[model samples]
Every structure is written in structure tokens, then in C-alpha cells.
Target: MNHHHNPPIHHHTTTTQILKQSTTILINSNHLSTFFLLSFLIFSLRLNVETATHSLTSFIDHDPSIKSLLNRLHLPPSSSNHHSPRVKKPFLQLTRVGTLDDDDFFSGDENPDHRFFDTARNIKKNQTLLFFDCFDHLGFVNYSDNGVRVPELVPSNGKVEFKLSESVGIDEKIDADDIYSENVNEGVEDFLKRFELEHHEMSALLFLLGVLSASYGFAILGFVVTYAWVLGIVFVVVVNDLLKGYKSFVRTLWDGSNLGLKRLSGFIVMRWAIRDALTQLLGVWFFGEIEDQYLFFKIFVRLKLMPFSIVSPWVNGVEKEIYGFLLSWILLDTLVSFVFAVDAWIAMADTRKSVREVVKEGCHLLSLMLHPAINLKLLEGIVCGSFARWVLAGLFGKLFASAFQSFMEVYFMVTWLLYYFSVKSKDANASGVPFGQRELERLLEDVR
Candidate 1:
């Protein structure tokens, strides 16, 4: 006898599931076009093109001062006074709002978390307050466990200050002078001893884990193909860095300062990368295997242009060799990741850090990198972060991936800005003048 079996009845959706579905739909609908456009601009702009901008620029502006401040901050200042200590010092300061338009993604005003809001609210003009870990009042030799360096960024204000203290002090002798000198060394040492203790940068570490995960994944994908592919990826990243003199290829395209110009410039750079990759491939085919080995070494050297290298392994052997190389890569990547964490502080605190200074920071972080515990965490972080990014990409797709990637790219951008800012600050501090209205003009010209 034939028996008819009814298909299993479907269960009704619960309120929670329906809400989640609706929320997901809303997010996708709202941000799909926005992220898609950003991706198009970011990737497409990597190619260089000629662009023209009319006088009708949009009112929205990209004020990196706030974002830079937040990205570089590792912890709350030990002393609240550090927040605006320079207001008392930067006499005759030339100040602007230094605010980003609401539309800019980094603008903290709209964020519910209030973390960036505190930073955005307090920044004065183009100036930022920075704390130091390795240096003390007595400088290098006084490497006190508690030393904190609070350096301030003072922009040009079109006027100069002459220190009359020496002239004024020459005529007046104070009883405190002799006492101050006698106790100066002791005072400095004591200060260092009282400084805040060094600690881990949890936020920066988290950020670095995410970046290194992608870097690790990219490197693995390279292994799956050939080492040459990994070098190609690193080459693209480095080339993007070199092109920052054009300043279009870094950060989210939403800055939109010179939208068309950036797109064209980025497009040109992208073309060069494509051409170079093809040429390298052709050379490998024609010039023999030596081309592959040369390309591998070439990437290693070029990466030195930045403050630090990610230390990917040279995998060209069986299971034993692969395991050895992978272990070395993990150890090295741990140190690299720690340095990256310090870099967040460097980003906002001093946008003008030299590669030499970056090297210095990397050197300091070596102590942390050597710890056995952190070494293990590095491997775990890489695997977890890479998996998270992969799952995210699989779920949300290329647009989301591009947006997330933009955030990491900005971390690198901070170092470049640090190089530029450090120079600008040094010159301005030396000159003692805010270059008048010329200051803003100079920033515009530089970004262009």
C-alpha cells in the first residue's frame, strides 16, 4: 500500500530571529552602496589617472587631527594635566577648530562609545599631548621604570617667541639656583622612579592581531601558489606606502579632500604595480629560477623602508622545514605585532616620527617580544584573526573586507604622517611662528 507522507511543517520565525534578520537587512541596505563605492574608489584609485577638481569642493573636510589622536593613543594619560599641559606653555598659539565633518568615518562625534569623543573634544588646534615610556627627565641613561614623557605638538602661529629668561635671570640671583643644581640629578632620578609602570597596549595589540592575521593569510595564500605571490602582495603594500607622497592611496576614500585627484593618482600607482608584477613574472620565465629568488630577497629589503617588517618565513621545504620556518615566522611576527601596537600611540602623539624613530620603538619592543607568553599569543592571534577576517569576508563580502582593510591601512598612514609631522613640528618649534594663514595653505599643498 502506498502511503502519502506530508512534508515536514516549517516552524515560525521567533521575534529575536526576525529582529536580527531585519537589522541585518537594514545594515546591508544602508551601507552596501557606501562601502561598495568606497571599495571602488580605494582599489580603482590605486591606478594612476589624471584628475581635475573644480572650485566647488564639498563642505565636508577630512580633519585627521582627531583620528590621528585616537589611533595613536595606547592608554589614558597618567596625569590628567597631560591632556592640556601645553595650553599654559604654548603662549601666543594660533588655533583652528581642527574638526572633521560629520560624514567622515573617523569622526568620533557620532560614535556611541564616547572613547574617541573624549579625545576629539580636548585636542587644541593642531597640537596633541604625547606620553613617553622609554625616556625619563634625565633622558636615556635614566631609563626609569616609571618614566613618562609628555611631548606636545605646537603648530606654526605666524609669530615667534624670544626667550628673555636668560637675559632676565642674568641680573637676578636666587637662593633656589644653587639648591636646584645640587639636587637636579637626584630630582630627575626620583621623578623617573615615580613614573607610571609600563604595561601592555591591549587595544593596539588587538588591532595588530587583525592586521597580522591578514598579512599571515596573504602570506599563506602566497605559499599555496608560490613565494613570488607573497612578495607581490608585500610589494603592493610597500608601493602604496611610497605613493603616499601623493597621499591619495592611504586612508578611507571618504576624506574626499581631492577626490578625483586621489582616484587618478591611486589608479596610476595600481597600473605600475600590475605592470611590475607582470614584468617580474615574465622575467622569472625568461631569466630562470634565479628571478624568483631575487624577487623574494627584493621584498625583504624594500620592507625595511618602514619602521618594521612583518617577518614572513621562507617556506621551501617538506613538513620539517615548513614547521621550522613557520615557528620562526611566528616568533618574529610577535615582536612585529608588539611594535605595531606601540605605533598606534605614535600615530596620534607624533605624526612626524622618523623611520629612525620607528626603528627605535621597534628596538624597545624587543623586550616585550621575548616574553614566552606573548610568543604563544602571537600564533594564537594570527590564527584567530585570520579566521575571523576570512569568515567576515565570506559572510559580508569584498565591500566589508575593503572597509576593514582601510582601517589597517590607516595605521600605516599614521607612521608616514608621523614622519611628516615630526619634521613640521620641529621646524615650527624652531621658528617659533605659526606660518600665519600660510600654515593651512602649506597643509593643503602637502596633502595634494
Candidate 2:
């Protein structure tokens, strides 16, 4: 039981087993590496071929004139008289030389009457002739026993100078005339249609302007009526207050004393402060709020009649929010104006105070009314109120100067986006490709 047992005798050779395992591993690794290397080479070659093909196709497709030139140069015998026996000898000789005047150079002649080589030499020297020669090579233009005839090319040169019969030239001329006349007639018809469209557009614009003028007139009339009613109420209240004071003041002044001068000066100061307060408040309330609301309503109505498909729903929502905020501000301002008017009426009625005290009170009221909401403090009311008045006056002054800068930034951004979209839309339409939603979104994102 304690004795150790030997291993089995049916064992594999260690060297053979190691050699077979190593060979198999090496072969598999080599195959995988070779496969990967071949794959990489094929992928790179495919990419290069695709890039080259794309470039070639782009060039050929973009230039119609080049395509036409190639087509003209490669026409078949049935469609082309380019190998005419008459010019074959000269044509072959010239092409074989590889350079002009080779024969003349070999003959040692300086002046070789190159005018005889005018048609061929001109075709070689002039680029314009290349276009015509290409057409002729395709048999679009052909030479008879007399000369060449190409009705399409005639307009480019004004007239053809070929030694042909009168009847042949006349026939070619008639055909060219018919083509030119057709082109002219088409142009005239297009011009007439464009003119009519422009005239109709102008008429529509004029009618819109007339309607706008009428609307503005009505708005102005409404503003005038509102203003008159408010002023009338103020006038009645002020007149009643002045009548109550007239008896006392008139008698005191008739007493023939210079003491009335002090009272007069105080009255003048009080009146000036009241006038200034009214001007500032009404300007903000009427011009900034009421009139702005009227204009906003008018603009909204106009936009509702416009092509809504051209505008995004998000933009419409933003516009509605803007109008809502403006309307709320307008209502708040109207309430503030009414409160100011009531305060003015109350001050006018109070006749117990001395003129100096009235002047001080008027100045205080004006300062309190003009002060911004941010600075209004409940604690240290008198001291904080005075500071707030001056601070708000300075803030408003700065805001006035900065307003134009803010407006300009908004204007430029809107105009730039509009112009970019218009140009992109036109280019896409011209290229006969419709833009996808993602592409439009990307364009808007870039603009933003």
C-alpha cells in the first residue's frame, strides 16, 4: 500500500508533441497577420479609388461645355465628316509634325506665307476656333465642295465667310434668321411676363401702404381723444383749486405789499415741478406703453395675414410671449399714471399749506413718483427715498444711451440669419436637391 506506482508506458514523444503544437500555433498566427495586412491594403486602395472616381465625376458633371467638347471630338464615322479626303493630306501632315512650321524650318524658309495655313493655323492658335472646330469635327458643321456651313455658329461670328454659291448662303442665312428670331421672341415674351409681375407687385404694395396709412390715422385719432379727455379732467380740477385761492391771494396782493413776490416765486417753483413730473410720467406711459401696445396689435394682425408656413411655430410662440409681456407692462403703467393723476388732484385741493411748504411737498412727490421700484425702501423711508430718486435718474440716463446698442445687436443677428437661409435655399433649389430636416437644423444651429 505504501509503494509508489510508475506512469503508463503508452506515452507520446515530448519533442514531437512540442513541435506539432508550436507549428500549429505559428501557422495560425501567420495566417491571421497576413489576413489583417491584406485587409488593410485593400481598404486603403478602395478609399483612394473612391476619392479619385468622385473627383473625376464631379469635374465632368459640373462643366457641360467640357462634356459637349468631348462628345464632339469622339463622334462615329456615320455622324462625323472629320476624315474628309479633301483636307486629309494637310490635316495628317500638320498633326504628324507635332509642331507648326516644321516643314518650313527644314526647308530653311523664314517667311512661309503662313496665310495659306490660315484656317488650320487659326484653328490651332485661337481657343475660340477650338469650339467651332469641335462642332465641325462632329459634323454639326460640314464643308461642301465650296465651303463650311454652321447655322448655330453663325451668330457667334455675326456672318460666315465661305466661298459658296449665293443660293446656298441664302438658305443658311434663312435658317440662322429663323433660329435668332425664335430666341428673340422668347426673350420678349419673358420680359413681358416679368414686367407684368412687377407691376402687379407694385400695385399690391401701394394698396398695403394705403391701408397702413389709414390704420395709423385711426390710432392717432384715438390717442388724441384719450389725451384730450385726461387733460380736460386735470384742467377742471386745477381751475376749481385756483378759484378757491384766488380770493385770498388777490386781496392780499391788492393790499399793495411786496410780500406777495415771495408767494409768487414759490407758486412758480411748484408749478414747474408739477409740469416736469407730468411730462416724465406721461411720456413713459403713453409713448412707451399705450402707443407701443397699439403698434404691437397692428403688427400682429399683419403677421396673421402673412404666409404662416414660412415661419416656425416656435417663433410664433416667442412673438406671442413678447406681446403678452408688453401688454402686461402697458396695463401696469396705465395704473401708475392714474395714481399720479389722483395725487396731483389731491395736492391742488390742499390750500392750508404756505407756498414754500407746497413747493417742497411738490418736489418730494415728483421725486417719489420718478424713483425706480428696485430702490424703494420701507425702513429709513425719507433718507433712502432721496437717494433712490437720484440713482434712478442716473440709471435711466445710462439705459437711454445703451438702448441703441442692444437694438443693433438684435438687428444684425436676425438679418444675418435671414440672409444665410435665403441664400442656402436658393442654392439648394438651383442644384435640384431638397434639404433634409437635419440639414436645416444644422444650418440654424450654426447661425445660432
Candidate 3:
């Protein structure tokens, strides 16, 4: 123990070391505090800017006048005048009318109106007869009363009229007598005499008959050539081939059954079955695969070929399955197509939900970062206290940022949900079914 009071060198050295350590600790602490404060401030400022911009954008979007102004600036109309309103007319009118049964008006007797009409008709006939009688008694050979002989109405001379009237009256009496007798010979002689003189004057009628004869001859020739010869041979060939094929199919399906052999019943059944199966399966797969694009065409073909089958319970089930798969395929195709079609900004705008998810994850990270530790109890208290103070001061700012972000996310989610529900409701309505949240939940309940 060189107790020689050696100046306390070790103590001085230890004191200097302690001072350096304290200075370093103070500097580091100050740096860390400054960094955290700066970070918090910057975060707050950014949040405020973002929130203000979003609020401004929402205000502009919601303002009809602002939107109209933007529209005018971006897209002026080609014409300046406003269009006039269209005029329409009412066409139909509902009116009340009395109703009466036919039996009530008619008591099984001739209608009085019908008797009146017949009487008027008889009066008109009598007037015509009287006029003709006066013309005959005049014996003036009147045609148009002005002595102009109308070609089609050439009147007979007086002598000719007298002779014709006498002959006609005598013939009428003779005709009446002949009608009561078995031998009606009185008019036959006169008719023969008339025909003998008129037969040579009948050239016009003969010419018409000749023309008709010629036309019928040509028609007969055409009919023989077309139907009896050309079509007959074609019909024979087709019938023969059909009968041969039918026999073959029948023999294949039923070798020895007498009924199957008769009328080619086996062939008919086999052919129909094969055609049905092939058409049903292939048609369902091909048309149902491209349903959205080809539904109308498929429907037309199916209705034309298999209307009854399509309405059958079995086919209805098949159709539903086909349509369900088609709907799923179309949805997938649409999603894929949209992936290629959408612009970057639009896609990003639609990802507000994703941003919210990211923010939630960030909150978890922050919680982890702010977790308290037992080892550095005093330091933890100081940090937490300081953090709490800053947070309280900036609470509104933090909340504003969070609320803005959350609003965007909520708005996007709600919009998407609305769109999805609207489309689903429309489809269900079109299909004559009800769609609601309950239905949707039921559908998705078993999806996962």
C-alpha cells in the first residue's frame, strides 16, 4: 500500500471516462428524440395534405355546378340551340256501350227491318219494269232517247220488236206446256233453228276455246316433264335409299324381332336415339360453353330442334347446370379481360380496400414498435410519456388521416358491394328469382 499519497491518478482517469460516457449518451438521446419528432411531424403534415386533397376532390365531384362547368370546358356542343320537345297525341278512348243478347231482340220471327228492305227492293223492281214497258210500247226504237244508238245497247226496230215480243210470248207459253210434258220438244226445234244460223257467227267463242285448248296442252306438257318424269325419278331414288338405310339400321338393332323388321321400326328407334344423344350432349357442350355470346343463337336452334325436350324436366336440369357453368366461366373471363383492359390509375383507385388492409397491417407494426419492455423500465416510461404527450397534441391530425383513409376504403367497398348487388339483383330478377343479402350469403356460404 504505497501509502505515499500518490496523487489520485486512477480516480481522475475514471472521472474523465465517466464524463465522456455521459456526453455520448446525451448526444445519442438528443439525436434519437430529434429523429422521432421530425418523423412524427412529417407524417402529420403528409396526412393533412392527403386529407385536404381528398376532401377537395370529393367536394368537386359532388358539386353539380362544378361538374357542369368542367363539362362545358372540356366538351362544348356542336350546336348552340336547345332541342324542342316532342308532341304526342292520345289515340285510344274508353267508352261505355249498352249490351243486348240476340235472343232478347229476335223472338223467332223475321226482323221488321228485313221486311222493309225487301219491300223497298220490290218497289224498285216494279219501277224498272214500268220504265221498260213504256219504252217497249213507244215503238220508237229508242236507244239513248236522243236517237244516238249506243253500241252495246242497240235497240231493235219497231217491226223487229213486235216479232220478237210475239215469238218470246209464244215460246214462254210453249215452254210452260213442255215443262209439264215428258217430251219438251217445242223449244228444241226453235233452239236448233237459231243454232244453225248462229253457229258460223260463233268464231269469237271458238277462238277463246282454241286459246284455252292451247294453254291446257302446254300445261299438260310441263306437268309431264316436271312432275311425272323429273321429280318422279328423284322421288323414287330417295325413297329407295331411305328404305334401304332404314332396313339396315333395323337389322342391326333387332336381328329377329318381327315387329322390328316390319315398317323398319328398329331403324327408326335406333336412329332417333343416336341422334338425340349426340345432339343433346354436343349441343349442350358447344353452345353452353359460349353462352353469354351465343345464348340467342343457341336458344333459336334448340327451340327449332328440341322444343319439347328442352321443356322436359330432365333437360331443364341439364340446362340449369349448363347455364351455371357458363355464368361462372363468363365471370372469370370478364375478370381476366378487365385485368388487361383497366388503366393503372383506375386499378389503383379501385384498390382502396387493399390500402386499408395495408394500413391495418401498419397499425399492427406500430403496436409492436410501441410495446413496453421491463428491462429498461425508466427509459420505457420516459419514451411512452413523451410519445403520449405528442400523440395527445396531434390526436386530431392522426384521426383526420385515419378517417380519410378509412373513408376512401369504405367508399370503395360500399361502391363495389352496391355494384355487385345491383348486377346480382338484375340477373335474379330477369330469371324470375329473388335476390337479397340473405340469398347472396346462402350462395357463398358453401363456396369456401
Local distance difference test, per candidate? 0.31, 0.31, 0.29
Question: Candidate 1 on 1-448: residue-level lDDT in tens?
Answer: 1112221111112323323332342244433343334434333322111010000011001333323322343222234355543111110111122111233222122323211211111223332232222223222342211122223321212121212223334334323344345445444333223321112333433453354345434433322222122222222232232223222333323233232232223322332343333333322332222223223222222221111112222223334433543454445444454444333333223336664575476445433323422443343355334344567669898446535544333323322222233333334445664322233233334323
Arrange candidates, best TM-score first.
1, 2, 3
Q: lDDT value for candidate 2?
A: 0.31
Top TM-score prediction, candidate number: 1
**RMSD per prediction, one decimal?**
28.2, 42.2, 40.9
**Order of candidate numbers by lDDT, starting with the best:** 1, 2, 3
* Count of clashes in candidate 1: 25
Estimated TM-score for each candidate: 0.23, 0.20, 0.14
lDDT of 3 by residue, 1-448 (tens): 3224221111111223323432332244322332233234333433443343344334444645433332221111213234732221111111121111232211112222101101011122112111111122122243432121313332322111111222233223222132223222322332223223233323432443354345334433332222122111222222222222222322321321231123223222333344334434434443433323122222323322331111111123247655553344334433332222112112222223343353343333223312221112223223323233346448666454433433222222222222223333444455666544334333222212
| Lowest lDDT block of 10, candidate 3 | 113-122
